[model samples]
Each structure stands twice: as C-alpha cells, then as structure tokens.
Target: MAYSFPEEVLEHVFSFLRSDRDRNAVSLVCWSWYEIERWCRRRVFIGNCYAVSPEIVIRRFPKVRAVEMKGKPHFADFNLVPEGWGGYVQPWIRAMAASYPSLEEIRLKRMVVTDESLDLIARSFKHFKVLVLSSCEGFTTDGLASIAANCSNDSVARLRFSRTSNNVSTTKLLNLREIDLRESEVEDLSGHWLSHFPHNCTSLVSLNMSCLGSEVNFPALERLVGRCPNLRTLQLNRAVPLEKLPNLLHRAPQLVEFGTGAYSAEIRPDIYSNVAEAFSVCKQLRGLSGFWDVVPAYLPAMYSACAGITSLDLIYAAIQSPDLVKIISLCPHLQCLWVLDYIEDAGLEALAASCKDLQELRVFPSDPFEAEDNVALTEQGLVSVSEGCPKLQSVLYFCRQMSNAALITIARNRPEMVRFRLCIIEPQAPDYLTLEPLDTGFGAIVENCKELRRLSMSGLLTDRVFEYIGKHAKKLEMLSIAFAGDSDMGLHHVLSGCDSLRKLEIRDCPFGDKALLANAAKLETMRSLWMSSCLVSYGACKLLAQKMPRLNVEVIDERGHPNSRPENCPVEKLYIYRTVAGRRVDMPDFIWTMDKNAGSPEVL
Candidate 1:
C-alpha cells in the first residue's frame, strides 16, 4: 500500500523514536525527510554507546524539542543504569546543553551532574520549559539561582528538584509556574521564604512540595495557588504541618487534585475532624488521597467537600454507612472510585446504584470477617453491576464474598472488562473455612471476560483451580494471588492456559519447587515472576529459570506472615536450603549444602 498523507503525518508517527539507530534511517530516507528530522527532538542515549553524537546526528534538524540524559546516580553511587553504562551518559547531557535550542523539556537524572553542568543548563538551554534534576546530589539552590537568573526571561515553566540536597533560594524562583521540591532536602526554609516562589509561574498545574522540609503556611500556598489559578494539583503533605489545610483548600478553589499526610493538632482540634473539615472545603477536587483509614463520621463530610471529584483515592478513608450511596449520588460525574475499606456488599450495592458511571473500582476490606464474607453477594449483584456500569473497565474487591456464580454473571454481563479482583476473606475465627471451591465462579472469569488483562485473587486457591484457569484465561498478562494456605492447583492451571502472561506474582501461595519444575517449560513468554514464600522447590527453580533465560525471576521468603489467625506460619526451615545456585540442587537431596543461597531461591 502506498502512503496517502503528506510528510507531516509520518513525521508525527516517528516522534516516539528515542533510539539513536532509528534516527539514521530518517536521515538516510531523503532530503524531504530532513524537514521531519527536527521533529525527532526527543533524542535518547547518545555519545558513549554509539559513535554518533546528538550534536552531529541532529545537524540536519536544528529545532530540537527535548533531550533526556539517562545516566545518573539516584543516591551517592547508585546510578539509574549500570555503573559502566554512565560514562556514555554525561557526554549526552553536555550535548543537550551545547545543542538543542528549541528544547522545552530536559531530564538530567541520577547524581551525574556538577555545578558547571547546572550553569551550562541554566544559561544555554534558553527555553528549557520542564527541568527535572531528580536525585542529582551535586546541586545547591545556587544552581537553581543560576536557572532563575538565566531563564527568568525564557520559558522555564516547570522545575522539579526531587531527592536532591540542592538548596534553592525560594526567592530566586520567580519564573516557574510549577515548582516541585518534593523529597528535596533543603536544610533551612520557612513559609515566609516560600512567598518568593515565582508568582509569574501562572501556568503551574501541579505543585508537589509535600516532602520538602519547610514550615509552610496556607497563606503562602494560597498565594501560590492564587497566582496560578489554573493549578489543578497541590501536595503539601507535611510542609505546613497540620495548621494550614483549611485556609489552603478554601483559597484554592480551582485546585482539583490534592494529597496530604497526617497533620498536627495545632492545625485542627482533632486530626479526623480537621481533615474532614479541610476536605469539605475543596468543592471541585477530582483526585484526592492520604490520611488513609477513615471513620464513619468523616465519610459524609468528605463526600460533601469533594462533590465534583471524578477520581477519588480514599485508600484509607472510612465508609461505614450506605451513605456511600449519597456520596456517589452527590458526585454525579464520578468516574473512578477507590475505597480502601472493608467494603461490604451492601455498600457496594449502594455504590452500584448511585455511581453507575464508575469506570474503575478498588475496594480493600480491612475487616476480618468469617466465611460469611463470601456469601454477601449472590450471582444477581454481579450481573447487575457488570451490566449496569457500561463504562466499568476494572473491578477490584477484597472483603466481599465472591462465588463462581457471581463471576460467571460478571463475565456474561461484561466480557470486555480489563481487570478483575476476586477475593475470599479468610477469617481468624476458630471454625475452619471448609474450603468450598467455587469452580463455577473461577470458570466464569477464565471463560468470559475476553479482555481480562489483569487478575488479582486473594485467599486460598487450590491446585484443582488450575484446570479452570487453563481452560479460560489465556489473555492474562499480570496475575497476583496473595496470602493463602498450601495450594498448587491455581499455579499449574495458569501456566498451562495463560500463555501470554508477562508478569506473575504468587505471594504466600504454597506452590513448592516440584510443581514449578513441572510447569516451568510452559511459561516461555513470562518476563517477570515473583514468588514470596518458602513453598518453592530447588529443582523447579533451576528448571524454570534455566529453560526461560529471559525470565526476571525473584524468589524471596516472607518470613513474618501476617501474625493473624487465618495467616500461615512464616517458613523457618526453608532458610537452611538457599544457595547461589539455589536450594536443593537437582543432582541429589542432602540435609544441607555449603551453598548458602542455593535452595533459597528454589523453595523460597
């Protein structure tokens, strides 16, 4: 087929090409392609690895837009890439400074920077709009002063100095619309000094100064928000301590995204009420989080405040009443709702009724309920919810009871669902769960949800469940089954059917090494695997890993199990077998071996 569109469409298609080798293809194409070369401004990995440098390679394209220097140490010596790979990285950062005039964004990562580099960047990169010097330890606020001095007249809009000790003279920062000093260790600063933040940074959309050490004031943050009315997100987790949340929220009405950590009583009489009152002030908050775990009293108030929020991340927010119905009803435009609570079917039923437009749902049940937890919902609620919410792409549940019938109903109703969470709340009560295998329910998930890409199953699942998985779920790419009694059925079933699987995590699932060796060869496409338990066997570990050389396998022992009743005892004997080669070598069985870390990765 011959291309119909002009040079511009193809140029846009090649915009994501970050590799150096592909840039050569564009250059060799034709003189017509030279016009498109300038569009490939986001050059990646130059100098050390390749003979050609960006300055030389980008000769035909002078109007470069951005450059990302990948080599850098996040901590003192911890380079983001391998140690030997960094000598190839610094030359490119120098190249970014020397070249690229039209550059708007520059990310100089790790600790691979110097004062001179910062100066070169501040002075040379005139239109450096977004600069992220994350984990770059060689910086001081004076370097930032250089940027403020040079790019004061330029379009340096957003500056993020994350995990850096670079002391930024807050007063010198006057051009940026968004200033992220998140996790930046500045020794001395107060709310008063923060007043100097570039008031001209009017386009500031997100400001994350949460981890920055400073006695912040709502007045200063309000000023920051007032100057930039378009600001949508503000994270002052502990900046202002607990004293200034209300003033900040009330002043910044345009703020839609907000996150705060635990505050001091000086901010509000009681932490809960103060946080609740603070939340109530934000009328348009779309995405809000923190202060995890909520009490019933605060639920209504939170809903009242974030009335217009579309994405609510109340990971620890308390929701006890059917008031969840009123909350969703209040936020009629709500799209994504995450309740990190021991959510009951009744509450979910209410949520289903009120928040019909929900696209993604995450519910974590923190309560310890008996086996009755699984019977909360019948097959009908699943059908109703899956059918009712036409836009729902992902559903996650923890505390709620789930049966085979309900899963089938969900599959029958919403086959296009991308992600699903089925959990059985194991109780600590004296009576055993009598392990009723919901064959019907597990089968529905495997067969129906054709678009099922991610699945997380909680509680104990047995080996018999494998046949169910092998029969239905072939499209799964990521699977997480955490905290369960000894069971190998699910693992075997998954390996047999889920051929396209890429990421697999079996947390606290007792699938010993023998089972792994048996199923190892079937999982060739798997790229990442995490087994956190002592149930893995040595023979299976080598067999699987050796067979799939590409497997990024991590086998670790989670020694301290959830000291809860239903949780199993932390494996103690497995520690004796780990070897560099792995525990329990396939050659023979012995009481112990000199290889300390050997049987380790195997049965771990």
Candidate 2:
C-alpha cells in the first residue's frame, strides 16, 4: 500500500495525464504499482506506445485486457498500397500476443492486414471477445472462416467486417449479438447470422450497419428480433428507409433508440415518408431524431411520436410554434434536445412551457453567433429554459449572447449544472473596435459557472480570461482555446491552476514559452494536446518532442490545403475537411500524413 494510489486518485490522475511526460511516469512505476495505472491507461489507444516494444511493454506492465491496433497502411499521397496492409504489424502483434493471455477486444482500423496476419491472429488470439476488421480489403472469406473456426462459439460476440472481401458461411456467424457488415462484399450475408445473435448476445445490444448495401436486408433482422428479445438500439444506413423502422422496432418489443443521418442525393419529396410511418408503429420508442428536407411543413404524426422521448433531435421540420408545442407536451419524460437549426421564439417559449422534464438543450440560433445574442438569450431564451427545465445541467455551443445576468440565473437555478461549452467570436463583437478595458463581458463566465469542468473558448481570449478559466473550472479536465493571432499570453492562468487538466487544445493562439514546452521534460499529465495554426515556433515543436518524448504530435500545415486555385485550378482552395472527414463522417480524412520519400518504409 505504500506506493499504491487509491482507485479514485488513480482514476482522477490517469484521466488528466495528457502528455507523454505523464504517461511514461505511469509506465515507470514498478509491477505492483503499474496494475492500478493499467486500469486508467486502458481508455487510451494501446498501439500508441511506440517507444516501447511489445515484449518490453508486456514485461513492464503485463495485465492488458483489451488491445486496439491502428493498422498502418502505406500512404503515397493517399493512394493506399494493398500489399502494405498490416505489413509490419504481424511480428509486433505476434510478440504482443505472446504476452497477454487476457485480451478481450481487438479493433483494427483501415487495416492493411492481410490473410497471413489474420491467420496468425486467429491461431494466437485465444481470449479475444470482439474482433473488428475495418477496411481490411485484402482479406478473403478463408481468413474470416479461419477466425470463426478458431474463436470459440459464443465467445467472440461482436464482429465488424467493414469493406472486407469475405465470402463468409451463414452458419459460422452465430452467437453474435451485433454484426456490422457495412460497405462489404460478403456474398452470403443473410439471416444465417441471426440464429446465434439475440441468443448469443443475450446481454448484447446495439447494431450499426447503415451502409451494408443490400447484402444485409431489413427482413433478415426479423429473424434477429425473434431471438434477441432485449435488442433495443439499431442504426440503419437508409436501407430499411424510415417507414420500415417502426415495424422492425415493434417486432423486437425492447427497441428504444433509433437514428439516421442526413441525405444528400436527389430524391422525391415523399423520400422520408417511411421515417414518419416508422415512428407510428414503435409503441415504446424513446430517443429519436426527426428528418425533413428543404420544404417546411407541419408533422402532426411526429408530434404524437414525441410523447415519451427523453432525448429529441429534429431536422428543422417544424414551421410553426404550435406544432412543436404539441410534440414537446406529449414527451413529459424529455430531457435532452439537439436542433441543428433554430425554431422561432414562439416555438422556444412553447417548448419551455410544456417540456418541464427538459434539462440540456443545444440550439444553433437563427442569426449567426454575436454579442447581441448574449443579451437576447437572457431575455428570450434563458428565461424560457429556466422557467421550464429547473434541473438543467448543461448548455453547450452557446454564442457570445450568454450574458452575466443569464449566467447568474443558470448558476442559481440549476445547482447541478457543471459544463458550459461555448464559442464566442469576441473579435467580431459589434463594438469590439471601440471597447474599453473593463467593458468586455467575459468576466461573467468565471463569476457564475463556478463548477465548470470542461471549457472550450475561441475567438481572441484575453490574458485575464485564463485566470478566470483556471479558477472557475477548478476540476477542468479538457480545455480548448482557439485564437487568430501571433502571440497571446492567455495560457498563463491555465498553467497556474489546471494541474488536473488532461487534454489541452490551443488553436491559432501563440505563447512565448517555446522553450519551456521542452521543459515538459516530460510533462506527463497532459495526453492529448492540439496546437493548430498557432504561431507555434519550430522550437516549441522541438520542446514538445523533448518534454513528452512519446508524443504523437500533429503539426498541420494549413498551406497544404490549397492546391487548386486562381487562374488554372479555378477553385481557391481544395480543403482537407471538405473532401475529407469534414464533409462526410464516412470518410475520415488522413489526420497525419507520412513524410516518407520513395525507396523508404511507411511506419517509423
């Protein structure tokens, strides 16, 4: 017990240690001390400990239960080499497999892993409970069959084979509670996999295969509903359409949560008639997200479906206040709501009057976020929310309109309130050019949001704000501050009090301690630090490397985002976000690109 930290202390400590300086310290502790450390460390990606070999990693601390390896694919300016899949990982994994006997879950993302690697893994992973092979294009059904043959029936519960070329046997996929064969070419994918699920996944739940094409059909899930009486959550990729969703949920009886994302392709107006019809059949539906297109109309049927939901999201469907009021009033159990578009004040007021059970809400106001919204919020929005949801806990993504008076009401009324995720474009404040020193309205955040745990600040935060931030958010674990300048001393206050801080995101903000960063001479507690477009000197990068030697730093060059522009190219910018993960979540763009030249290897 001498060196052993308490479970709570270990949890708190592990949760906040974001930098390599902090992680290495956890790894350095002796075997007995490392056990407690391992519990907290499991939340992070396992393959990231690159500085330590698999053999050494096991020798150092041997109780790893779950391992997730981000399969390294060969990147040549984004043309992934088929042969490069899981090329170097076989040996490293063989080494890792030789050590851990208690491994439970394994997820290989965008796997460059081949048949040979999967063969070795099947033979080796004796205790693997879940196996996810995402984008493992090189694999065939033989490798998948091998995994099924090797894995004990009912032991391997969840299998996600996305974009894989496996010609799987129907009977081989039994005992699975969830099977996501999305974007796959699995020829025999049908109801054969259902016999084992619901029964195999007796305690199992949640199925997500929104983009499985026609390989997996809604009718097939009818067999799944018959077996797994407890199945509650389902996410379909426009396959079942919306109208069929309710019938599917009704068959399961235990179904509750359902959601589908936006549609971009050209379609007729009655495209989501299925969505409206589906809600009608679900007698016990709970969490729901409504979808409607360009034309605005009243959905009386949707209002009826909103009766018992605790969390609701509507796709800008409600044209008038009365329609939404009917929907909110029916949902007496409603707690959380997210709206991508704003409804009029009448709708807000109507919602406040009815949904007394509402607690947390996110509304992207009609007008763009500016200082005026702050005052307007207190009088119009905040008053309505306070009058209705007295037990409100969190309100995120609010603009600069969140004033001191509004902040005071929230603190006084919602005592359990802890987080206030905000983005204020103070530089764009109407009177920002003529503002006096003491006239800035930011001080209210520190004064009222007393127990703030997470703070995301953007748009020219002053030096004084940091002090208030560190003081108010005393239990802060994640702090993200975005700026648009060269040097701003706003970080000093955070450095003073946020000893428990875990993830720090400094965007477009600059500081002078470019050298002290290396003094992070291994700043161990900080794990996920993001510095984007900041006037961060190269010296600071070097310092970060020195301080946290095991850091997987991402230094984004904004200039690289523009290649097609001006006279010849036409478009001014070819943005990474637009073409990458930003435009669509399905395609997560390459976050960090390799700088490998020809004749060199990919993974370093």
Candidate 3:
C-alpha cells in the first residue's frame, strides 16, 4: 500500500519549489501530483512561443500570474531572420487577456509587438507590475504612452473618489512597478510619453528607457523620479545630456543600478563638482553603465561611486586603454564587466590585477569588419583574465587572432566556465601560430570545463571538434555554429550526443539532410533547430513534417515563388521545432508551412 501526501500538504510543498525544471519533474511523479502541481504553479516560462498554444497553456495551468515567452531564434539579432518571420505576441496576449486577468508579469524576447498589443496589455491586466521587452520590435512611443496612461485600474477609482470629495488625495493611484525595454528597437515618434504617467505615482521601482533614440521631457522625468522613492534601477538614453544627470541622480539617491546618458560635457569646475557630489550620495549604487559619446575629462567625476560597483558596462564608451585602466583599478569589487576591445591586453591585465572577484567578462569588437588586427586584442588578454579571476565562469571574447596554447591554458585556469562564446572576426579563421584548425583549442574547452552549457564556436573547425564536443559537453544546452564543420558527420556527432541540447543554430555549415533525417526523432526532444544556407532539401523537410505530426518544420525562402522550387532543391532556411500549436497563422508570403497531411509544403 503506497501512501500519498494530502492535497494541501502537496500544494504547500510545491510552493517552495522555484525552478521550472524541478516543478516539471515533480508534476511527472503521478496523475495526482500533476494535478496538484498544475494548480499550485504561479509562473510559467515558454522558451518558444509556438511550442505550445496559449489555449493549451491556459488549460494546463489555470492560475498562472507571470509568463515569459521568447519569439524568434537567437540569430534574429544579427538580421538573419526575415521581417515577417512570424513571432508575434498578439495571439498570446489576446488569449491570456481572456483567460488570465490576474497576470502580473509579461516578459518577451525577440518577438513582434505592435501598438495595438501594447494597448491591450496595458488595459487588460489590472494587477500588472512588470513588462520587459528585450530585443523586440514593431512598436512605437505612442504604444508606450498607452501603457503609461492606463497601466493601473485603480486610477479610475481614484479619479472618481477625488471628484466626489475635494479632500481626497490621488497621489498614489497607479500600481505599475517595472518597465524594462533593453535593446529593443522602438520607433521614436515622440518622447512625451513620460508626461502620461499619473502625477505623483510612487509605485515604479525599475525603469529602463536607455534604448530610446529620442530625448525625453526633462521636467516630467524629474518629477516622476522624485515621486518614486522606491526606484532602484534607472537607465537613461543618450539624449539625456551629461549636465542633466546630476539632477536626476539627486532625485533618486537610492538607485542600485544606473546607466548614464552621454558623458560629454564641458570640463567646468562647477559641472564636475555637481556630478561628483551627486554620485557620492548614491551609497547603494552597485552597477554602472552607459557613457555614449564619452569625454575622457568627465570620466573622473564618476570615480567616487566606482568603489562599490560590482558590474561595469563600458561597451559604448570607446575610451582608450589608459582611461579604461584608470577606471578598472578603482572597481576592486567588480564581478561582471562588459567592455569594448578598445581596452586592449594592458587594460585587461590591470582589470585582472584589481578585480579578483570577476565572474563574467564580455569584450565586444569596436570594428568587427576591419581585416587587420588593429585593436591590439588577442587570446592573451583573455588568458590573463582567466589566470587572475579564479571565479570566472562566463566569457564572450571577440578577437582577430587566437592560439591553441592560449585557449588550453585559459580552459585549464577556468574549469568552471558555463558559457564560452569566442567569435573570431574573420569566418573560418585558423590558429595564427600553427595555421591549423581550432579543433584542439575548443576541444580543450569542453574537455576541461565540466559545467559548460552554452557554446558559440568560431575559427576553422572540423569533424574532430564535434566529436570532442559530443563526448565531453554533457550539459551543453545551446550551441551556435557558423562557417565551421567539415561534413554531415560533424552534425551527426553533435545530434547523436548532447542529450541536453535544447537550441541548435547553424549557418554556412556543410551539414545537410542525412544528419537531420537520421536524427529526426531527436528534434522532438529539443526546443528548436535553425539552419540557414545549408544543404537541407525541401523533400527532407516535408518527410520530417510528415513523420512527426507534433513538430513544425517550416521552410523560409525569400528568393522566389515557394511552389516553383523543386523537391531536390536545397531550402534557403529551415526552422524545425516541436509545437503543440499545430501551425502559426501569421506567416508571410516567404514562409511555407509543411503539413503532415499535405503532399508538399504550402504557404499560408
């Protein structure tokens, strides 16, 4: 006789479990646990929006309060995906509005969001608190104004009460809390949206409008910041000049993370003192970012707040190695750093010496298309950081040249690396020292790093590197490949292995139908597979779609008529994913949806 936990006891136990993976595992114990877990689940994450229909989601979890959904593939950021490649949030928002009225948070990435959808979201969820749209597009400032004006339902009730009684105060009517729009491409119609927020609304805790290209109304912004006492994170755009920063900082002295505007003001004594005094009072500041059009003279004004900063982002500053070294020496407690390769090896060495607690580092290429190794950054800079920062677990380094010996040493130094993305500027670049493929170097990375999860490969790679990855990268979840791999055998090695691989993106690789068809069943276990400029034929895509009714195999070809292409002709782009939603209806002319019942692919 097996004993079962009481329903209330099970619910209470499930409430303590936060990880989506753990909750999913718990729900699979039995039918009883499934029902119990379903009822208790409050937040749900949909990695791919098309993986499951919103109707299925509503049926599975009836009381969800927060939802996080991703739309397009990661390569969409590089303009590889077409305009109407179809990852719209309208359908999901409409369904959730009808079902989950109490939803408090909605986080979207790489998705299409129109002004109508924004207006709907602002008006639908009465208790909405957080809205994060990262790397999203197809929206304007008019849509933002809609959100600012009607985010909270209490505003209406407060308005009615204030009209009825002259003594009643409507200072704290709005309940909206956070609006994070990082790296989103929003059309700058106007910056007057800040004025739409209810006067004296004190609920905002985090507001990031740094991606906006237009200037915001300064008076409205100052008043809003002054009233929101709990605001902890504020990221301004480049339009907000450096001189106005001191005023905003004075208003929000409790900010924990701050992204400044253009740091290029006149080197006047009064301006410098005002900026220094404002930063001195921000005792709780821990993260600093944004310095667009930076003037080296104004850099010293921020030195007072550098001691406590654990995360520093100088990717946009374009400051030279000398100024970078001066700032890096001051941030002794720095843990995460994002900077351009303008820092050079000397600056990185200085960072390694000063910031011993660094955990993550990202070095972006200021001039990616330059054929020459002009920036003076190489594998040595990363090797230096690996030697100094013992706790380093992640790195994204973009360099022109690398050596097998340097990578092996770095891997040996940082065995705890979880995400390693090395993008050699030139495609299929070989090792500079020996002029050989980068197999041994990347092979050393997977073999040594036991916790490697996300990997982006570059440089000249062959089938041998894939063999190494298939054997050692047991926990790898996401892989990005471009202009590498020798043959279909390379793709076969990865598909046959990598049990936890959830997202696989490949472009300009030699893989084709054989590897994909042989590992057809593996696609159902993963989230998605995106391959473009490969050798995958239309016939192979159709067969895969027919064999697996649960999967959505889409062919995206913008060349010409979809029906004119032959069965043996290679597809321009193939997007395959496991989907319970059957088929998406928003696909444009270029996208051809492969149906199980149909003999050939059909354009919707």
Candidate 4:
C-alpha cells in the first residue's frame, strides 16, 4: 500500500483498466496496485499453456503485447488427449523470446505448433502482427512459409487455418488481407493455387478455403473474385458443387459472409430457380455457413436470404422436421443456431416459434451412433425452447430424455443462462417424469443461474447434486461431469466449494482414492484435472502424485505397466495439470508420468 497517487497518477488510474477482469481487480489492490497493474498490462490470456510459466508470463506482464494462449485440453477435441499428449508452442516461443521482445499478436488454441515454433515466431517479433491458430497441430506448409517469408509486418492482417497443413507456396501477400483455410489437410486444392493472387490484387477482403479436398481454379476462382471488389467473405469447398454454386453466387453478389458449396445437385428446376435467383442479389447477406449435401429441394433456396440472416451454421445439415421447419421459418433475425440432431422436436418447435432473437443454440449428433431409442429431442423439446426463446443465452442441448418439469421450466424460462450444456443421452438417465435424481433440476441451475459460466452435467446425479454445486456455483468456471455423481462426497463437495473452479472433467463417476485425494490443496489453483472411467487407484494416483509436487500427475495407461499392474488396479486414466514446463517432452508411449522414487508409472 503506497501511492494515494503518482507513479504518473498510478499510470493514469491503470489506463482506464481495460478489463482482464478489471485488470484482475486492480492487481489485487496492493503493492502499489501491483506495480501499477504490472506497468499497464497489455493483453495476456494463457488459459493453460502449461497453466503459467512462460517464465511466469514473462514475470507477470511487463508491458505484454498480446498473447492469448490455450493448448490441448478441451479434451483434445474428443480424441481425448492422445498423440504425444502435450501442447508445446516451443516453450511459449522460447519464453517469449527473451520476454516478449515486443511481441505483437499470437493467438493459439489446442496447440502443438512446430516448424521450429513457426521459425522461432518468424525470427522473434519485430512488430510481428497477429498469428492466429486454432485446433493446431504440428505446423506445416513449411511453417506457413516461415510466416509468409518472415512476418513482413505491414501489420499483417489475417491468416486463419484450422486443423493445419495446406502448404502456402512461397510468399507474396502484400498487406495481406485474410486467408481462412478451414479444416485443412490439403495436398492439392485444385491446381496452381489460384495463380497466387496479384494481378493487381485488390487486398483481398476474405477468402475461406472451406475444408478443401480438391477442385478449384474455376477460371482462377473467377479471376480472383473479379479482381477483388473488396471481396466480403466467401468460403467455398466440398469441391464447389451444385453447379459451382450459381457461378459463385453470381460473382460474390457483394457477399457479406456466405459459405455454401456442395449442397448436392441434379434436380434441376434450373437448380432451384438459379440458386434462389442468386440469393436475391445477396442484399448484404449477414452470415450463412456452408451447406454441404443439404437439399430439401434446395430448402426454398434459402427463403431469399432469410430476412438478413444473423448466423446459421446447420452443422453439415441433415435436414428433417419439415426441412427444419422450412429453414427455421425464414430466419426472423436468428441469432446463432447450429443444427443437425436432424432437427426433431418439430425442429425445435419451429425454432421457438421462429427465432425470438435466440442467443445461440447447438444440437449436433446427427447419428453419433444413434439409438437411445433413436434419440430425438426430449423434455418436451426442451420446454418448447424455454417457452419460446426468451432470449436463450447459449445452449448445447443433445437430447434423449429430460424432465424435472422440463428442467424446472428451463430454470424459470432462461434466467439468462450463460452456457448450459445439457447432454442427457441415456447416461445415468433419470428424471423422465419423476424417476428422481437430477437433484432439483440441477438445483435450479446453480440456484437460478447467477450468471453461470459453463456447466455441463448429465442426469441421475446425487450427493445432493454435488451439494447444490458446492453451495450455488459462485460463478462456476467450467464443470463437466458425466454419468452423474454419488460418493467421494460428490468429489468432495466440488473440491471444498467452487471458488471459481477452473476446469474439472470427470468421466463415468464414483470418484476413487478418497475422491482422488479430495483436491489436495485444490489441485494447485485448478486449471486442469481430468479423470476417466473413474474409481481411481494406482495407490490413489501415487498419493495424488506425492501430494501435488506441483501437479503434473498423469496416468492414462491404455494397458501395460502401472509398474506391471496391481498396486490395487483402478487407475485407468487421470491427468492433472499445472506445469511450469516440467515433465512434458511430448510424453506418449501410453502416457504415464509421475515417479516419486520411480517404483511405477514413469516410462515417458
């Protein structure tokens, strides 16, 4: 406690504290507002890039310049963290190449990133501008042609790539605009890479390679969209079918985000009146994702771009329920809807009587191995979209059965639910009209959704619904349990009450080894802990890795040595986190690391 002012008036009151949670509450209000919010911190997210230690975020943000991390653990996109289970971004670009050498942008997700850490972040940040990567993998296209011939920072605009490797040939990109290569794995996205743009390249606005498999160069992508009339956004792939999507929607009818390509063809009524008269001359289309194989007689050719569509991704549309109630009864200002549980439950009750400004919904599972008696929507179509979408604030409903009066009438009609993922696909299935346990419909969702931050639970829970989610989820930060709970005091009453629990994902249930050592000192400030198939043992994960010697504690044996088995079996899978770059030189060979006196589980 010092400065009642000065230090340039506390860096001008922490430069209007641009929320990283109000500059982490004024750097916990002390130590001179934590050295003036660490000399005016500049963008740092790091949600588990080894949960802290790029030399402790370059010694706590000394003029940090945009970092946004995240690597492997989002259950490694459901393959469940296998292949060399570690997320490396070359030790945070060799610890921010000597502390953020004025690093610019570097957003990465589900990381692994190689090509020598993108050629040491293109020779370590000389005003390196933006490098976004998502669901990343070992880098390719020779590390994106060494970040397009060494990050020539004309403040590099955008270069989005999904699931890596499309091979960016050499480099040109003058003042590069945007090149989103979605779902990549390209060996050839049809011939001569659209003649490497630049026949007077009008700074291309946006060009998404919609999961290319082949077939491109349609007159060099319509002469680079007719010499880029500031091309808005065009995502094409699925080998661009349906008769080349009405000549690329009549040359990008001034597209404002349209990603449709292979929506099947052959039934010509002049291909649904020439693709609904080329999407009624686009009228600044507001966002519609690629409709691969979608053809319910061309769903009335997108009802003339559905009243200024506001985000509709049909997750690879499988269309049913009256062609998703005639394409969600013509959008009606839809606010984010991702479908394909083949839209049953009368297509989400005609999308809650036509999209009452619905704020996000996802329903995947088209036939993810179908049958929970052929699951279609339940809980009476999720209480008729929570009694007609009172602005539903985020959902990911994958249904089979549900009830407790339809989850207490969707927690009294969507009490501003911020991300509630209800996936009752017959696991621990209960509450179907009072079979009980779903403890008060998830204790009325953390006691009336007090701004819930991500919660995913299945049915038939107990230990009084993890003791009402550890006495009313104090703004719970991510919890996903499956097959509900019962003992180990429901994971020790959510590790002695959720004080903003970072992340915990359990599988199967009945947690073991005294509920995996009842959160020994709450797993070092929680950022990760995943249990699989439950009933933990191997001497309670070697006594919770000898009482959290700064937690890394992995144990995901597929089978083979937990020291040649029988330390009371039961440890099938567990993975704890919190690493300052210790033990993770890409540990694979059946992922087992935790060796206090190496009597067991070590082998890389």
Top candidate, metric TM-score:
3
Where does model 3 exceed 4 Å of error? 1-3, 151-174
Candidate 3 — worst ten consecutive residues by lDDT sum? Answer: 151-160
Off by over 4 Å in 1: 1-9, 15-153, 156-196, 208-215, 236-246, 249-251, 259-285, 288-307, 367-384, 427-435, 483-492, 510-524, 534-604
What C-alpha lDDT do the candidate models reach, one value each?
0.54, 0.49, 0.91, 0.76
RMSD of 4: 21.9
Q: Which ranking of candidates, highest TM-score first? A: 3, 2, 1, 4
Clashing pairs in 3: none
TM-score of each: 0.61, 0.63, 0.96, 0.35
RMSD of each: 10.7, 10.0, 2.9, 21.9
lDDT of 2 by residue, 66-108 (tens): 5655433212112322233122445556775677655555665
Task: Give per-residue CA lDDT, model 4, range 1-604, as digits (tens).
Answer: 4665678877787778776878888788787788778877888887877656677677877778888888777866767666777777897798787777777677787787787987787666766556667667675555555554543324443454545677543332333355555553434524446655446555567777676566776887887787677788888877788767777778778888888878878788987888889899889988888788877787788788888888888787677778778878888889888887777788888889988998888887777666655545666776888789888888988877787777877988888888888887778888888798888988897888888888998878888889898898888888999777777899888888888887898888887888568667887888888888888878777777777777778888878667777777886678888777666656767777786554256664
* Cα displacement (Å) at residue 387, model 3: 0.6
Candidate whose lDDT is highest: 3
Q: Model 4, 113: alpha-carbon shift in Å?
A: 13
Can you give the lDDT of residue 515 in candidate 4?
59
Tens digit per residue, CA lDDT, model 3, 91-183: 999999999988889999999999999988877877788999999999999999988996443545443346666766442223789999999
lDDT of 1 by residue, 1-604 (tens): 1245576776786776667668767656766565566555455432112223455645645666655543321112312122322223445556665666556666544434555665666556555556665444444555544554543433334454645667543222223444454444443334454454444546567676555454555565577677666787887654454445666776677678887544334332365565567676666678766543334454444656655778766554554546555666677667887774534556566667767678987776555454344334433444566767778889876544455555667778777889987654552111123346555555677678877888876543556555766676778888766654345665666776787776665656666655565766554445445554546654444344555443323322223222221223332222111112222222112122222233223321
Q: Candidate 2: where are CA atoms >4 Å away? A: 1-64, 67-102, 106-175, 178-204, 210-216, 260-284, 290-299, 302-305, 315-322, 364-379, 398-415, 424-427, 430-441, 484-487, 510-523, 543-604
TM-score of 3: 0.96
